[model samples]
Target chain A: MNLPKSVSIIEVGPRDGLQNEANFITTEIKKEFIQHLVCAEIKEMEVTSFVSPKWIPQMQDAAELIQSCYSSIRSIVLVPNKKGAERLLATNCKSAAVFVGVSNRFNQKNINKSTRESIVEIRPIIADLKSKGFFVRACISTAFYCHYEGAIATADTLALCQEFADAGVDELSVADTIGMATPAESFSLFSTLKQQLPNIMIAAHFHDTRKMALANIYAALQAGIDRFDTSAGGLGGCPFVPGATGNVATEDVVYMLERMNIKTGVKLDKLVKAIDIIAPHLSRKIDSGYYQLTKKRDISV
Target chain B: MNLPKSVSIIEVGPRDGLQNEANFITTEIKKEFIQHLVCAEIKEMEVTSFVSPKWIPQMQDAAELIQSCYSSIRSIVLVPNKKGAERLLATNCKSAAVFVGVSNRFNQKNINKSTRESIVEIRPIIADLKSKGFFVRACISTAFYCHYEGAIATADTLALCQEFADAGVDELSVADTIGMATPAESFSLFSTLKQQLPNIMIAAHFHDTRKMALANIYAALQAGIDRFDTSAGGLGGCPFVPGATGNVATEDVVYMLERMNIKTGVKLDKLVKAIDIIAPHLSRKIDSGYYQLTKKRDISV
Candidate 1:
């Protein structure tokens, strides 16, 4: 029953959410989506990623999205390397995120490097961002279970977190990349991380592939970790990791937290509206329970 | 995490799951669905409900289903009143479930009686069944919240449980009829129910309306309640309760329990196959997350 009075939700629909879509969403529509989120009082968001357009065609308008929109709130963009970091630095955004998979096989497949090599590559990027007075978040992907490598050792994930902490990252996010994490794994992993690294801030990122995302988020909350990465309309999935679904829905998370008397500072009705704005643009159907429930209400009423 | 080594799953698909379907599924298909669940090692199931065909045309073949399909497992049937119980007596099924909404407003709308009046009607039914050596389970519907009544008082729900327990009901099922219960609410409610009625068995039943069903189940497990009422392929919703969706998916529950190293005595693969068997016969999409993932895997593999 012990939980934080308030939680910080980092909305990632524009970046992680749209990047996996089979269809292309126009830049104007992306900005409109971000505007909807901002209207709903989502202060922190990953607007877009600065990865190469050839790598992910869905995110081809990353630069255009940052330049045209993302002025009112704290916008965090994903930067894969120094090149992506350079592009992010050119934008008006001050916060940047970097990801490194804990499993070697996953890292090799995802980022084309071993865990050690990826860590080595991101160390200077973190230092450079810190020197520039920018907030850097290091995400440890596949922290619990990896589709390619199977179960990952906690020691390996923690060591990666240690590396990020040493490199002076402002915060760390543990991701259930393939959405295979159970509540027990979520609690134990996040608890161990919190206990080991008391100084570093921790965020939880989960996929709903196995329908344990919200449960994992609840478990993470019980472990004293508060910040979470969520997607509006449950819009994201891992293209590289087979069977990975969208992040836990933002409206669903907001609803649960608010009902429990926990503060999320986000309006549920407005969040649903935001989801409705972009729901038709996506190729896949929205997988959010709250979103679906809201639609049902609209029809019945 | 102090979870039970083996959890009991009472499958309610044949009754609760199919009752809300818009399409008419034949009794043959219903029996095949029950057989698939039995093949998946499900030992306890609610085969069908003995309600009026006029009330729920989908469950009109309840007697024929119980007579033909349920042989190897423990079968439970839903009986709304003494009349329904009379029909249940004609069948070979020895277990019957009766429900009353915890909220008076919900009970009045759902069953055409006040909460207390509904309890009064079921007391004689319980006495009649117990005298015949039947296992009677009393379900408190809308235990946490109600669509018409909004948030229900915990004291009111516990009082209803006391009434049922005093009436010699064998077990109690706390249902979130609208799926509005949060993790904290689920844990606190079930924990209080367990503490107040330590001798009586308690089972958690939830709808996934707000997508908190599994999270609520995880919370209930933390509160030391091991038995759950789950519907296969996440079927079943309260037709009277607007915006209420399916029950917590059985395959999803089994996946979480097995991954947490808790035994459910149910095979995940076999359960998915059971869902696959019935997936084509349904009018709506299969709402189970594990079932969706299995479909994706099927397409890819």
Candidate 2:
């Protein structure tokens, strides 16, 4: 396929992939992962999160991981509320991502709060993040569907996006947490989200559990939204969300977009090389059809 | 990902996957691969091609490969034209598929015939198949892009598709040969194809070279198209087409669609069980991220 001249790769393996690994993966190794990402010519990375270990053990060392990493690339962190935002205040990371679920059931399951309650709670945190002159993004989860509650309504999702925008978030991330979306849903939602909130720059977060992550990205692109969150090797799919498999593999996404003449700004050979550096670290083989297929035989053997 | 109630697994490994492999897998091994696909619970299979042995040594043994098979599943062979279709007339295979390329350059490169010439050649062949009461399908290739020519116009694709529909082919299959399509393009194409040809069923054949296969499938589904073509273990991509990697994995597609609560009529546990029979003989590791990530520990080790 003829791809666009360039596209962006927002690396999320450090925060999304590592967050669910069974092994602790010391903060240093986490640093190595980030280091290799940079060596691969990556310009943006979601390094870690500021959250209590009680909720997720994988992210317990987020603060430490970020502290150890030294790079010019933009580093984004996940912050749940004002307390989490306050904790990131001391870190030098340039961006903070605040999340709220659009589906009521997902909000309750993800953060132990109602959709409205989570929106109200995350708003001030967003304001606080903006006040600090940091790039603040509101990640709207289950904006597509919720496993517990089934399909999410457009009205409910729109209200949450408006709240995030009104809260002064610099950017908005619409996510299909369960990978339950089709291109039609993504296109309509992204298009409507843009029409209503004309000022917000939108990024897309899709789960590949249903194998539609890349397609969702394509739909979002058609709706004129750019910026995407993808895991290296298609590495990250949330463990907390049952049936969810992985995010769109970074290399695969870059490959598809590039061939279609859409610019993803990702270096193909360099990204594949980065996957090589990561191959030995994990106990299991990484599953990216794109990598397994295109990888030169010498490396595969 | 939430899947539909079930999804159908169309095993294309033996025909599609092995076609590009440089290694000479003998007739005996080809039989074993077919058996393994059945073990994987694949309900429908495209097992072999009736093309000349001189051109494709990999598929030289159409008779032995088909005769040695031990399963009860329906099998179809791919025929480029009346000559290939004539070779398969004596077999009990019941069905065969002919291809039409949207790009003349690809058609000439692939079958040594121009796009219109290929269609003309296949029409009479399709008529003969009809007379014999054999089920036949016409696959339109390069519906999205071509290595030699980029971003094919929709009108050209539609004209080719209309030609096949007018010929009374039972189904229409659109392929993104080089992984060059996005969901918007897929949706738009599928919508237009379906609207123009209401009686004929539409199937999607995608390559994952640029990581947009699943996304394209999602778009087709949104456009209300079903009956997709996928490979066992995500085998086979068009090698001649640079940057193309593999077809969307059958297991991954099943997992995603089944979890979505759509009706695909495939069983996942049965599918995984089916793979055990041929996993060892596979020349390369399976190119599927979900299978690699969620592999049963015993097999992975």
Best by DockQ: 1
Which regions of candidate 2 deviate over 4 angstroms? A1-9, A26-29, A35-43, A53-73, A81-83, A102-121, A147-149, A297-301, B1-75, B79-87, B91-94, B98-204, B218-228, B231-246, B249-301
How many angstroms is the interface RMSD of candidate 1?
Answer: 3.1
| Alpha-carbon RMSD, candidate 2 | 6.3
Q: Give the local distance difference test score of model 2.
A: 0.75
Model 1 Cα lDDT, one tens digit per residue, B119-164: 8899999999999999889988989888887788888888889999
Per-residue accuracy of model 2 over A7-34 as CA lDDT, tens digit each = 5677887787767777677776677767
Docking class of 2: acceptable
Give a tens-digit lDDT track for model 1, residues A1-301: 7898899999989998999887888987888889989999999998889888888888888888888546678899999988999998887789999999988998888878898898888889999999999988998899987887788988988888988998999899889988888999999988998999999889999988878888999999999998999999888888788778788899889888888888999987888888887988888888687777666643321
Error of 2 at B37 (Å): 11
DockQ of 1: 0.62
